[model samples]
Target: MRASDRAYATLLDEIQSGSLPPGAVLAEVEQASRLGVSRTPLREALGRLGADGLVVQQSPRVTVVADIDAGDIRELFELRRALEETAARLAAVRGDAAAFADLAGEFAAVTLGDADGLDTYYALIARFDAALDAAVANDYLIAALRTVRTHLVRVRRLARDNPQRLAASVAEHRLIASAIGARDADLAAHATHVHLHNALESVLASLGGGTTTGGAITTQGAA
Candidate 1:
C-alpha cells in the first residue's frame, strides 16, 4: 500500500477503536514521525479523513479527530434507516433466496457468550452486508451504505457491553434475512425498520441518554 493509504488505515482504525478519541490533536509533524511517513502523505491521509468527516482542521496546521455526540448519532441513524430499509427491499426482490436462508440460519446459530463469539457474529454480519450489496447491485446505493457503515463501526463500539441488545440484534437480523429469503419485500423492509429502531434506542441508551432529541423515529414494540 501507499504511505498515505497506510497512514489513513492506521489512523482510521485508531479513531474508530477509540485509541485516538474525539478531540485528540493530530499534529502533522508528530504524526508523520510516529507513522514513519513524511508530511506530504500524512497530509493526504488527513485530507481523506476530513472528507470522511472523521477529522477536522482546527487551524492552518492543527487537526483533530471529530467529535460525535447524540445529534450526530441520531442523524446517522436517520440515514441508516432510509438506506438499509431500501437495501432490504431491493435485496428481497433481486437477491438469491437460498443465500439469505443460509444467512438466516447462521444468524440463528450465533452465540455471543465470549469475545470470539462476538467477533464471529460481527463477521457474519459483514457477510450479510456483502450479500445485500451484491443482491441489490446498485453502485450508488452501495456507496451510500459504505459511508453509513464507516461511522457505524464506532457507534457499535459504544453498545458493545449490552449483551441483551446484541442478542436482540441477532434475532432482528434473522427476521430480516428470513424475510428477504422468502421474497417478502414489504416484510423485509419492515424488519429492517424495526431493527434500526431498536438499534438506535439501544445505542442512545448506551450513550446515557445523551441523545435526547425527539428527531428519532418513534416506533411501537422495538426489539
Candidate 2:
C-alpha cells in the first residue's frame, strides 16, 4: 500500500478502536513521526479522515477526533435504516441464496461468551456486510453504506460491553440472513426495519437518559 494508505488505515483502526478517543489532538509532526511517515503522506491520511468526518480541524494547524453524542447516533441510525433495509430487500431478490444461507448458519452458531467470541462475532458481521454489498450489485448504495460503516465502528464501542444487546443483535442478523436466503424480500425488509428500530432504541437508552455524558454507552446498534 502507499504511505498515505498505510497511515490512513492505521489511524482509522486507532480511531475506531478508541485508542485515539474523541477530542484527542492529532499533531501533524508528532503523528507523522509516530507512524514513521513523512509529513506529506500523514497530511493526506488526515485529510481522508477529515473527509470521512472522523476528525475535524479546530484551526489552520490543529485537528482533533470528532465527538459522537445522542444527536450523531440518531442521525447515523436514520441513514443506516434506509441503506440497510434497501440492501436487504435487493439482496433477497438478487443475492446467491446459498451464500446468505451459509451466513445464516454462521449467525446461528455465534457465541458471545467472552472477548474472543465478541471478536469472532464482529468479524462475522464484516463478512456478512461484504456479502450483502456484493450481492446488491449497486455501486451507489454500497458507497453510502461504506460511509455509514466507517462511523459505526466508533458507535459500536459504546455497546461493546452490553451482553444482552449483543445477544439480541446476533438473533436479529440471523433472521435477516434467513429471510434473504429464503428469497422473501418483504420479510427481509421488514426484518431489517425491526432490527434498526430496536437498535436505535437500545443505543439511545445506552446514552443513559438520552444524555451523552451518562455511563459507557450501554447498547450496541447494528453494524
Shift in Å, residue 64, candidate 2: 0.8
Residue-level lDDT for 21 in candidate 1: 88
lDDT of 2 by residue, 26-124 (tens): 999999999999999999999999999999998999999998877788789879989999999999999999999999999999989865998899999
Which candidate number has the best TM-score? Answer: 1
Report the number of backbone clashes for model 2: 0
lDDT per residue, candidate 1, 1-223, as tens digits?
A: 9999999999999999998988999999999999999999999999999999999988887899998876788789889989999999999999999999999999999989965998999999999999999999999999999999999998887554688988999999999999999999999999998888778877877775432334444423222
Candidate 1 local distance difference test against the native: 0.90
Root-mean-square deviation of every model = 3.6, 4.6
lDDT of 2: 0.88
> Which pairs, if any, clash in model 2?
none
Residue runs of model 2 more than 4 Å from their true location after superposition: 211-223
